[model samples]
Target: MHRGTNLPAVGGYNQALILDVIRRSGEGASRVELAEKTGLSAQTLSNVSRRLLDEGLIRESGKMVTGPGKPRTILRLEPEARFAVGVHLDPTVITYVVLDLEGHVVAHSRTRTPVGTKPEETIRRLTVSVNAIIETSGIDATRILGIGIAAPGPLDAEGGQVFNPPLMTEWHNVPLGASLAASTGLPVFVEKDVTAAVAAEQWMGALGDLKNSLFFYYGTGVGAGLVVDGAVVRGASSNSGDIGHLIVDPDGPLCRCGKRGCLGDSVAPVSLVLEAIEAGLVSAPTGELDSVTVDNDFTRLLSLADEGNGHAVVIVERAARRIARGVLAIVSILDVDRVVFGGPFWDRASRAYLGVVPGAVADDPALMMTHPIRFEQSKLGADVAAIGAGCLVLDRVLSPKPTDLLI
Candidate 1:
C-alpha cells in the first residue's frame, strides 16, 4: 500500500535474492541478520532491507531479544501487503484461489474448462475469471505478486507450457504461465498439480521442518510430490513425481502415458469406474464426475463403498492395493518419515487404502522394523495444493538460498 525505498541496482543483490533469504528465515530479518546470512556487507543489507521495508512487503515487529545493548526491533513480513493467485486446472474445471502472504485464501472463484474446447479459448475464460476474482477480492493490482497454475502435466515448467497430459489433450504446448502473466500483468509460475500440492505440504503442511518426506498424491490420477531437505525436487524438467508411470504390472492394461501396466492405468479413478461398469453397476462413461449425472464427487464414491456396492468395493479395494504397492515402493527408495496422502481422490482412497497401507509397509519384511514408517491423511484437505502453490510466491520473497551469494 506504500513505498518503502528504491531497489538495489538490478544486477546487484536484488529483491528475489534478498526476499529468498528472509523467507527461509521465517519472513523477517534484521539488517544485521540479512547481511550475515547473505554475506552482503552491512551497507548493502541496509539498502536492500530499506527498499523492501519501504515497499511494505516486510515490516518491523516489536523487538528481538538482543544480548546486552539496545533491544533490536524484529523484522517480519507484512503478509497483507501482497497476495498470490493459485489456479488448480484439471480437465474437470479451473479453481482459482487468492492467498495472502500467510497462505490464507482471501477470495476464490471457479469455472469449467469446457471439455474438448480449444486451449486458447479455455485460458481466455480463465483470464476473465482471474480478472473477476481480483475485482471481487478488492485487492490492489500492485499488491498481487503473480498467478501460479497447478495443472495436470507433462509440463515444460521453465517454458511455462503444458505438454499433452491425457485428460487435457487440447492443451498441447499451451503457454499457461506466459499467457496468464501477459494477461494479468503479473509473473506466472506453472507446476504440475500434484507437485504443487507437495510443495505446499513441504512449505506449510504436516511436513513442517522434516528433511525428507514423500507425499502420496491421490487424485483423478495418482502421482506424488517429493520434498527433499526443504526443497521441492524437480526432475530435469520440473516433473519428478510422475510416479503414476511406475509399472506395478507389466502385463496390465495400457496406460495413457503409453506404458502398459503403469500405475495410472492400474490404480486411477477411471479404472475403479470401469470395474463398476464391468460388474453391471455403472452404466455410464467416466467423464468429470461433476459433468456426469451420477452424483459422484468422492462423497458418492465413498457412500457407494459404504453401502457395499459389490463392484464398487472390489474396484476401490483393488485400486487401493495398487496404490499401497506404489507407496511401499516410494518409501523403500526414499526412506521418508511419513507418507501423506491428499487430493480430490483422497476420500474414497482413504476408505480403500487406510486399512492396507501400513500393512504394505510392514510387509516390506525386506526392511528393518526397528522403526516403522508412519502414514497420514492431509489435514489441509482439498485446498492444500492451491494454497501451497500460492505460498510459492511468498517463499520466493522470503526463503534464501546459498546461490544468492554465488549468483
Candidate 2:
C-alpha cells in the first residue's frame, strides 16, 4: 500500500487531468487537442492551462500552423518543473532513483544497508543518500514533490512502521515513513516493495493500461502485487501481496513459515541457489554459499543458465514450473487478465522463467475462468520498485482520479 498526502484536489483536479492529457501526447498538445482528450470545455481548458503555465508546470513549446487559421500554441509538460525520489530498502542493499515529471531516472545510487548497525544509522544513511542525489543532480530542491520508500512488508503502511519483515528483524516498527520525512525535510510515503513496483508498472510500464494484473516480484525474496479494478490491492493491513507464502507444492519442501512447499520455499533466490548447489550444478566450496551471498549466488547460477549450462537450465525450469503454479493461483483468485514478472533478479531469471512459466500457466485448468490472459516480461527492469516509489509521488500530486472529480 502507498499512502499519499498533500494533494491539491480542488480545481487542481481539472488541471491535473489536463496535464496528464498533455503528457500522454508526447511532443505537445494544442488547446483543442487537450480539450478533446481531457473532455474539458474550451473555457475550462483555457483557465486550467493559464493556471498551469502560471505555476510553471507547463510551457508553450512552439506553435503548430493550421491550413486556414492562425498558429495554435503547443503546450508541453515542464519535465524539470517537478521531481520525486524513490528508494528501495532491500535487506541486502538500498537503491535510490530520482525521477523527473516525465518518469525518467535522472540520477541513481546504490548502497549496502548497514544491517548490523543500529536502525537509526540505516535511516540516517538513507537520508544522506537521498540528499546526495538531489544535491548532485542539480535539480532544484523545491521542485521535488516528495520521497517514496519501498520496503519489505508485513508491516503497517498507514502507521508507517515495519514489523517483523523476514530476515531483517532490525527494522521492526521502525516508523520508516515519518523518520525519512523528518530526516529529508519532505513529505514521505511508504509502500510494500511489490506494491510499489506495481505502481511503477501502472504509471509507466508496458502493461500500464491494464486495469487488472499481477506483478510477480522476483527479488532477494519472492512476492506479488495485485491490481484490481485499476486500484492497487493493499489488503486490510496493507500487507496484501505476501504471495511468497502461498503453498504451491504440498509435498515438496518445508517453508520457514511452517508450510509445505510454499512459493518462496520453491523459487526464491536463496532457494534457487541452494537447489543449484544440491544438484551439483553449482560446485562452489562449502560454507561459501550462505545467507549473505544468496543474491550473488543466484545471479551466478542464472548467468550459467544463460550461457547454456544444461544443468543450470534444468534448475531454472524446475523453479519456473513451481513459480507458474503460484501465478496460476493468484490469477485464479483475482480473476485478473494479465500477469507481469519483475524485480531485481528478473533479468537474470527472465529468459528461463518466461520460457517455461507461460506454457505451464496456459496449460492450467484455471485458464478457462478468464479470457486469454496476457503474460509479459517486465520492461521496467531491476529498478521497478525504486521507479514505482518515485511514480507514487507523481501520482499523488498529478494523476487525476475519479475522486478528484467528485468535489
Candidate 3:
C-alpha cells in the first residue's frame, strides 16, 4: 500500500500532483492517465483517488477503453468539492471571484472602494461578500480553504501586511491578512497582485515550461514577478517584484515612492495620461484612474492608437519604450529567456512593446551578442489575479516534494 502525504511544511505531494494534473488538463483525465503521467502505481493511485473522492475532490464518470479487456474508469476533479475566495482590491472597486476546486469561478461579485474607504469597512464588505457567495452557492463554509487576496505591491506577503500601497492611501503597516483571518475565521493569504498574476500565468499563461522567466505585470500599477528555477523569487522582504519603484530616470519626474524618474513614474498609465495632457498632445484626458479599469483603458488605448490618435500613440509608445528599458535590465542580469506581459494595461503595452522591446534589445550591444528574449501575451486571461489567488491555496495544498514515490 502507498502512504498518504500529510506531513508538515511539505504539504500533500500526492494530492497536489493529482489536483494540478487535473487543473492543467482542462477536460479532465482518467486514473490510468494520471498514474501514467505521475508514475504512481495503480494501488497508490487508488488510495489517493479514494481520499480525494471521499473529500469530494474528484468524481468518477464513465469509462474509457485501453485495449480489448476492460474499460477503465475515468476520474475527474470534483470542481465544486471546495471553494476558494479571490479578491482584487483595486483603488476604486473591489472584484471578487469564488472558485471551486476545479478552478471554476462559480460566482463573481464586486463593489466600490471610494477615495476614503476605511480598512475596517472594506474588510466588513469583503466578509459579507464572501459569505454571500458561499450562501448563494450553497458551498459549505468548512470546505472553503480560505481567502486569497490579490492587492497592490509594497506589501508583506508572508505577514499579510500592507506598507504604503501605492494606490490605496491611508494604509501603512496594516495587518490586512490577520484582520481578514480574524473576521472570516479562515486561512487568509495576502499576495502582491502581480505575483498572483504570475502564478496564474505559470499554470495557464505564456510562461509555462519556461523555468527562468519574468512576468511584467502592467495594470492599475506596474510590477514584475519572477520565477527563478521554477520557484517564486519573493526577495528578502517577500515584496521583490514592485519594480514600479525601479529608478529608470535620474532627473525625470516625481514618483509616488518619493523619488524622481522611477519607471512607474515614467511609464505607469497614470504618468502616461498626465504626460499626454501636459504635453498638449491630448486635449482632455478626462478619464479618471478609477473610472476606467485597467482592462478597459488598455483596450481603449489600443483602439485609439489603431484609429490614428496621435496623442494616444505617443503616450503608449513612450510607456512601451520605458518598459523595454526596465525589461532589458532584468533579462540581461538574470539571463532570462522568456518575458510574458499582461495586466489591465497589456493590450496597449503589448502592441507598443512588441515594437519597442525587440528593437530596444537588438540595439543593445550586450543582448545583441546573445539570443533574443521571447515576449508574448499572458496565456491566462483578464481574471489572472483572482484565479491565481485561488490557485495559491491550491498550490499550498498540492505542490510536489522530493520524497514522493515515482512509479
TM-score for all predictions?
0.85, 0.89, 0.83
Q: What TM-score does model 3 achieve against the real structure? A: 0.83
Clashing pairs in 2: none
Which has the greatest TM-score?
2
lDDT of 2 at 142: 94
Estimate, for each residue in 1-407, the C-alpha lDDT of model 3 and write its tens digit: 12334333323577777777866676778887888787777777777788888877888888888789778877777777778888877665677788877667787776766567677777888888878877887878888888999888788889899878867886778888999899989999888888888887775444557688888887767788888888778788777786776776677688766898788778767666566557565455345545455335555666777677887787777677677778888887787888888775566557666877767766866564366677777865556777778878766665554465443
The C-alpha stretches of model 1 lying farther than 4 A from their native spots are: 1-42, 64-67, 249-261, 282-298, 308-311, 365-371, 401-407
| lDDT of each candidate versus the true structure | 0.72, 0.85, 0.74
| Candidate 1, 1-407: lDDT as tens digits | 11122334442335656665555567477776766656666676677678888888778887777799777666776768889988888676577889987677888776766877898888888899988898899998788888888888799877889988887667778888888888778888888888888888776645466467788877667778887766677788888888878877677678767778788778766665555656766565555444433225344555677788776676667666677778778877777767788876675568567877677667765555366677888776767677667876666655543354452
Ranking by TM-score: 2, 1, 3
